[model samples]
Target: MEFTDHPTGKRLAALSLAALGVVFGDIGTSPLYALRECFHGEYGIAVTPENVLGVLSLIFWSLMLIVSFKYLTMVLRADHDGEGGVLALTTLVKPRKENMTRGAWFLVILGLFAACLLYGDGMITPAISVLSAVEGLGHITPLFKPYILHITLAILISLFLLQRHGTAKVGTLFGPVILIWMASLALIGLHQVVRTPSVLAAVLPWHGLHFLIANKLHGFVVLGAVFLVATGAEAIYADLGHFGRRPIRLTWFLVALPALLLNYFGQGAHLLSTPQDAFHPFYAIVPRWAIIPMVILATMATIVASQAVITGAFSLTSQAVQLGYLPRLRVTHTSASHKGQIYVAPVNWLLMVCTVGLVLGFRTSSRLAAAYGVAVTASMLVTATLFYIVMRKRWEWKLPVAAGLTALFFTVDFSFFAANMTKITHGAWFPLVIALLVLVVMLTWERGGEILAERARGLTKPLDEFLKGIADDPPKRVPGQAVFLTRSHNTVPVAMIQNLRHNKVLHSEVYFLNIRTEQIPRVPNFEKIELERFGSGIHRIIAHFGYMEEPTVALIFTLCRDKGVNVDMNTASFFLGREKLTIGTPPAMARWRSSLYLFLSRNGMDPAAFFDIPSEQVIEVGARLQI
Candidate 1:
């Protein structure tokens, strides 16, 4: 069930609090390095009073326009059955691919690429966040400088290793800890802001515009670092299903946005007074005594941010697999109460490896910051593009209205993206390369699945024709029920044909089961199964599930029982087709793609295990196919 389904007072408050921990984690932790990067990072500018106000203005308006207006107010409404994300948005716009326009298809591909980009963001967020937080120790004492990298790596590794245990136990602490973190940000930032009230004038858009006009090309480059403040904005929409729109919006407006603004302005205030502290303004505002405690709290907050990103990656993988863009992987549901909490072993480990590599390679958060915003900015651009389609197609907005709003969003997103592009030589290429690789995999997996399905259709006979043949030349009748898994209910399963050919017998009750994934987030139990009886105890049952859900044999049987189709699991023998794919004479795919596809197919989770089917009752019928 969606978190927003029952929006009572207590539930809404709880969800909003939870939203603070998860949805705002990435963006919430930006104070550690965002403003510092603007003045002291790879493309950092001079710390003049005007420049400081300009940068602060840019950061301020970005949060207001991009995060607050575009994402929270606009994109959040584009959810697909209460689910949000690039994949969810893609499905919402194009529920069915039949007769889709070229523009529509491009949006879908763009959305996939966008989702792939998040994987890159997922890797960088943890590394940079933890590194930036740990770097605070160096400010405390020169003694810790040598151990900063080691400490960051240790913390990151420990955090990832704990993924299998699930977040339920520790998740409770996230809300309270983040609440404290946000409170600390506001209090410290306010302390600085009160000392230098002039920093508040950065709220004016003219300071930002004047800085851009005065600095020219250099000012444009500064935008790349300035964009860091808006990095985790996408997570707000992504976690929509988990917390609901109201709670997420409420949290951002009432809690996250205010704290973030106060802290950023405070950093600017500190910078205006003591420009030398530009190296670490976030820590500069803290009292000497509180520096160590703040460091500890910052480390914990960054860890929470990293956890959110890791969880997002797992969720994205599940959605991509169900939506047919990715190969099926083993998904372990972490929280019994929260369906959104899941663990994918492969994703978790791959992320840990990449994240650790980033920390080791970059050596510091300032260097890692150069690579951070590229994927996120690109992803936001994709979201704006997709949101335009959503506004037009789903929301039915007028052409002018849709185009105007999209253009505004596009301008902001593209500016950030273009600025980030300049960092390609520094370190941004890493995430871009990662994104490209993932996009290729997604495209290959999707194309390969289509080819395999086409080949399977050619090999299997039509269901009506096969049933008529069975009626005319009746096979030897056997006791119990036989459940044959098929991709389409309109065709006979190759496994069923192979079984009858070898054993020359049919079970008394035959169930031709087809499990289909829908574009929506979920299908209600009542509408999940469609049962049609052909004749002679032969039935065709189509189990419909949403991309967010897992399809299992046990659940199917239970649903069948509810539909008056008594399915005795103990007596039922499940038949499955195990295809051994080989390269065709005229290669349907490029050689490398074919090889990758083959490897993925070979390594993919077994169907029986994936569907939670009983292994002893599953009878695999082997078939050779070329594609």
Candidate 2:
């Protein structure tokens, strides 16, 4: 039943192969444009040996320190039950002392913003990655130039359309092909390196510093393009649960890191000898007869890369919804064995539209490159800030130790961020604007939900005490069981209270069901149900779920029987309370914000359907309130 059953070495090797297809796919394809961009992009500096060696040195060190150390060595170790991401990191942070400081709130907001920016990354990465890959066709024939846009569109559109079908199959098959891709990158770059031995000298740190000194501001600008090499580094940690630290670290250190540095230096060496090759150095390095074949391979690699990001976006959105930051969304499980493979309709279609729009608007990879690095550097910096908090507060590291590591991360992160900042007017504003809008929506919903909870709390009555009153009165008891869904355990459900008040009768047995999503990804099956009994046939049932899990009423019923609470689904009635919000009195939020919250509430998904309650067995009680 396990995914991997081989010996540790073989199993790790298989997982590492799969990791290349998913974790490193995005960064893997960077070779197609990263080095080329340094010398050919709009901000590209002169192709002198110093600049070439400097850029190569920067690219190499960036991968080791940023991707290897900061992420694999540091951030990957901070997983929340083996989950990693900006939102996941937020859960790890504890208050530095007590009363939430403005600083604590700032870290929280920064984490949210960092998470939001990734949607933009999701859209832009596919466009730029695919565009850059297909653009390689230009190297073969000028005839392909006019048709490049059309070709890119066709590939991207096809890729997005396939999301509904899921990528489990493609992911399975992509492992070897990606190995071929990496091997091809190394082989081709090695061919160039052998011809030009002088390029290896750039491996030293002095060349990078000397180049930066000679070029000054221009060198800083080139750092923005160099950043493309490590943009997919975040995937290393994001996918820690899938492959584990050993496989991912092994892949990075053994396969990916070496191939990337050699290829980059090879490109630098080639460019030093043949400066005219800057146009499309990645494809240019290939033999003339192999150019078309290499382009084909590169395009396929880009598709797999795009698949990883698209899949990541879906997973993140699901987590956000489960954690209560967003409204209920329709989530479809694509694989019976793999709960992680999910498809979201709204998110899928929205990303498609935005991704296609980016392709059409940006027109070329060179132009899209300007918009790419901004969000990446910003999110990385935010992660550093959060990671520092975890070290100091959670891990109990000394402030100086935490500060030293944070400073190292920040230096690299900020240098890239400052370099990319110059891109805002050109195109970097895109992700920032998207992140800001999403931040507003998230914050508004959070505050609005808090206000609603406050009002609901005021109306809550102690369940045991309320049941005692009913016991004294002895309201007429009916047959069959009533399951009332409540938001909290300590309070009586509004539906149960209303049913008693208006209907003047209670079911023979009443069950108060409260569902709570836990911070971890999944609750153990044995620990899913917790029950407490009270007088007058009143029972409280608490169901627990992980963020990655779906909680269904049917599952609850099935599991409850094993825990000594038996019920027949055919005869049971499910009760729900719908609150209609009206903006009046001391409004819970600003006028516009209140309206936004109301709009969201009215359109919010039906809890019955979301919980998989039988439609025929459901009864609703409605009440109006001013928030």
Candidate 3:
């Protein structure tokens, strides 16, 4: 499937709207709670005119500098090929030295953690976005307040259940629904802006500066809530693969940004006239007749935002598996034409359980707000750190220029992260804990795999020496071909060796195939396969792929055919080795980690299934691996 990274004409127009539905959905829904959280959440500031304008000013500039300039302009340029995100960034930026230095390893760790925190963002987004939207009922009547939790749980459960179906059929509605949602924000806010024209003064940068000074420490802390408006800014960079820079930038500048600012100013205008509405400023500005309809529209918008984050998680996990940060899991591609549209059942079920637990535990969007910004800000800060290196090491920019730009991004991000850090005791620990858990699992899998591979490589005999031994001894050759999958190209596969030792027979044609996922996103078809004949009936095959791609048995055969090596797929049998891991003294890690890796290895998808080999034609040989 080919994607027009740079689309023009109707393609661009369609994608721009599609970007609104997916890319901007989370940030777009911020109007539901961003302002109200400033004065209504656990940290309630007084709703005085000075404070109102001050918070408004912060929201405006944060969106401009952070979302508009930093992400859309700066970070998007650091994409791996056309892919963006911290994981993708890890592939693009390299160490100056051939060997990864300590500093380079630290940056890699930062990227992995950033990727982990994004999972936190993914989980929290649905809980808060949908809850905030559903909270609109409280304003309608005190009578409906009792049902909010039940109603939210229903919506969330329904959302996760629908994930298996893919969004392709209902995706068309996303653009139109969000279009109305955006238009409503602008139209609704435009009316209030006209009424209290004084609110327009919030756009000036000085009011934000003054508010910080007047409030002192209090104002600084206010950043935690104010940062909520920019919660989904990372999604723009994350979703660059779906809608490229032009459409996302164009939509933000033209549609989503304007509507957000207008609505926010309108909320400020209404609050100035009625400070009592600070508790729910967003819905307060709505006319009585329009409130119910607005809630319906807002609910739809949040659902889409939640769906986008969930799908993004699936994509991220797929990348992690290919990159060896995780054990392979079953990934279901839901869309026939789109490779990116994937569904992972374990991920879906796990997220559903956690997100539902969040609603039950937090009980309200305002409380969940306590947990939102910390993960997101931490992620953004990590991304900025990696982006700095890309500009310096990858792009070859002047040292001072790289340092200056990085510092600038750090200043803004650090402010938010520091502020969010203060809320750790107040529920922000939820995402941090999640991030830590994910980090341990990811690091353990990677480190454990390295040790296992090293040990396996040491045990393997050279292909030439093994072939000569077989040629000299002449093990009885059988009919048809046999393929052995190996982790290392230079070493003989364990399955083949075990087969020879036990069965004492060889196939007429033998293939020692090794598939390695490179740090890059996609290996070109021309450079994918490396085949060498070893003078007997043995062939060595090495296939390379990027983390973003999946390898298939058919592709390997096709590449072999192109390289003048004929393959008889119908007559070939593939052999896979399943490791039964045992814990050795120290075991390359702690006992706990060894057990975890073993569990993952045991439960992981079979290679035959993961690589698209025919199940009937595949045989599994189990070997004990003491780590």
Candidate 4:
């Protein structure tokens, strides 16, 4: 792995600040209404001092355990290529099995399903965050109540409109605004805390435990509310590669976490001092003069939060393509300098449409919140399971220690998942719909690839026989040396053999390059391109790479030479078979689904970008196939 120093002298601060804006924005904004909705929602709570403080205590400690301990502190370090998230973490942790076991495959499918769920959460975060912030207007002035829908729609439209531009461009303003938002939360809540000093007792963390133990009947319900605070915690892991662990950890511990806890405590204190304000304590703590500005600032914070999630979805899709779970989608480099910063038009539009629907359908932030946490919780739970396997198999830790850690998380997660299940009837399907769609696409891609590979293997000739025939009748016209990238095992690619036979063109040395995905994500960099002599100046080059890493043709060719494979990059041309699929009867995919894959393939990432191949030297040979 290549590690570079901070981009500038101020890089530590700048990256930390940017991470605060991008990574924590979604989770950070949870305080806007996490508690209010907790008290007011189906949990059936009153504006009493104990209930508010108890719930506030739960919120604070939940963040400490789930976000701080379980994820930020521990899981962020389990990054794959500086990337963290369920999928990235999965790429890091997949264990070797002698054969595919039902349990192992079950876990794989579950984790993928969890990833699909995040797309749902991605759409919901913006909808709920924006709506909740806009809803704050009702507290400031009653006249704003009737126009809430219009105001929300307008704000949402503006938010979606701003997305064409990358977050890095407008990110300079995010930190200051989030800083102010957190400061105001602390200030407002602190004022109320001073008014009712006893409210500080809620910080003991035991009150949260007692709430669960004493109120066994409704503990699960309260957990549903508590989970909201940690809704976007997975983003921290998913976006880990965007900003390293040090800066993100520092930002959270030194800045974001403190602000959130203080404000949550402050809000609790205010509720105890004036029960009436519990109806809208976040705003009630503020002065009339400050309420409007607070609303505006909150709106900005929510928009930023939503933007981070949107960007995360884009990154996840890119990873999916490289890993072969999904067919390639057109990936436009959003920043020429950063390979990580990319834009997928289909994803952007899909998220935009779903978000707009959420804003319109829910119409209120509180309603959207019900559907939000399920996906995030499921995603975190999946990460925990994957990490547990890593600790045991890769890290070779004692099984008890890993199981204990995983159990703690699973207990909390399962409880929350069950709680959220109560909400399945109330518009949770929006996310489930997106998850199902992505699952189908991913599974179809895998199945289709398998069927196609089996078909190719059956149809292709043996390597020894084909090469023997080639030696007997050598072609006259030729390039100095040529390498053909192929999927056919052992034998030469059908196209290359066919081209040599018909065009009568042959190189002094013909290299067959076959790239394969291994079970693990990291192979020694030195072992990149393996070579074998097939005689007659013909060598087979099998390049090995972990999906987490990029495939650079020049670098691979260089590694081949270093490994004693006779190949020259400047004189060699790369031949990539472009398999054009025409839909036909295949048990792997239905007609409509096959159509979708074909359409997605046509619109997918350009081969040049996907393979990191230079366009001038890269040649695409069209191969027609029915899958």
Give all candidates' CA lDDT scores. Answer: 0.91, 0.85, 0.89, 0.76
- Residue-pair clashes per prediction, in order, are 0, 1, 0, 3
Which candidate comes out best when scored by TM-score?
A: 1
Model 3, 1-627: lDDT tens digits are: 144357899999998988899898999999999898899877878999999999999999999989998998889887787788888887776553378888888888888888888778878899999999999998889999999999999999999998888887887788888889999999999999999999989989999999999998888888999999999888899888777888988999999999999999999999999999888989988999999999999999999999889999999999999988888899988888767789998889989999999999999999999888999999999888888888877889999999998899999999999988989998898888888888888998998888888777665687778877987898998988899999878778888888988999999889989998988778889999999898768899999988889998899899889889887787789999877789998677889999998888888888999998989999888777787
In model 1, where do residues sit more than 4 Å from their true spots?
A: none
Candidate 1's displacement at residue 510, Å, is 0.8
Model 3 C-alpha lDDT versus the unseen true structure: 0.89
Which runs of model 3 end up more than 4 angstroms from their true locations? 1-5, 94-98
Question: Of 2 and 4, which scores higher on lDDT?
Answer: 2
Q: What is the lDDT of residue 523 in candidate 3?
A: 82
Q: What is the lDDT of candidate 4?
A: 0.76
TM-score of each: 0.99, 0.96, 0.97, 0.89
lDDT digits (tens) for residues 1-627 of candidate 4 = 322244445888888887888888898898887877777766646667667767878887788889899988778778775557787666555545465677777777877888888789878888888888888889877999998888877877776666666655676677777777777777777776777788778878788777777677576676787788888888887777677888888889988898888778777777776777655667877778988999999998998888788877887786677678887666666665655566777888888888888888887777887776667777777888888988887788898898998999898788788877777777776788789889988987777777667666664677888888877876674557777887755766866855765677777777888776554444577877778887777888888876545566777787876777756666668777778778775534788777776776776676566667767777777666777
408 in model 1: Cα distance from truth in Å? 1.0
Model 4 pairs in collision: 84-237, 189-266, 329-605
All candidates in order of TM-score, best leading: 1, 3, 2, 4
Candidate 2 structure lDDT: 0.85
Go through the candidates in order and give the C-alpha RMSD of each one to the true structure: 1.1, 2.1, 1.5, 3.5
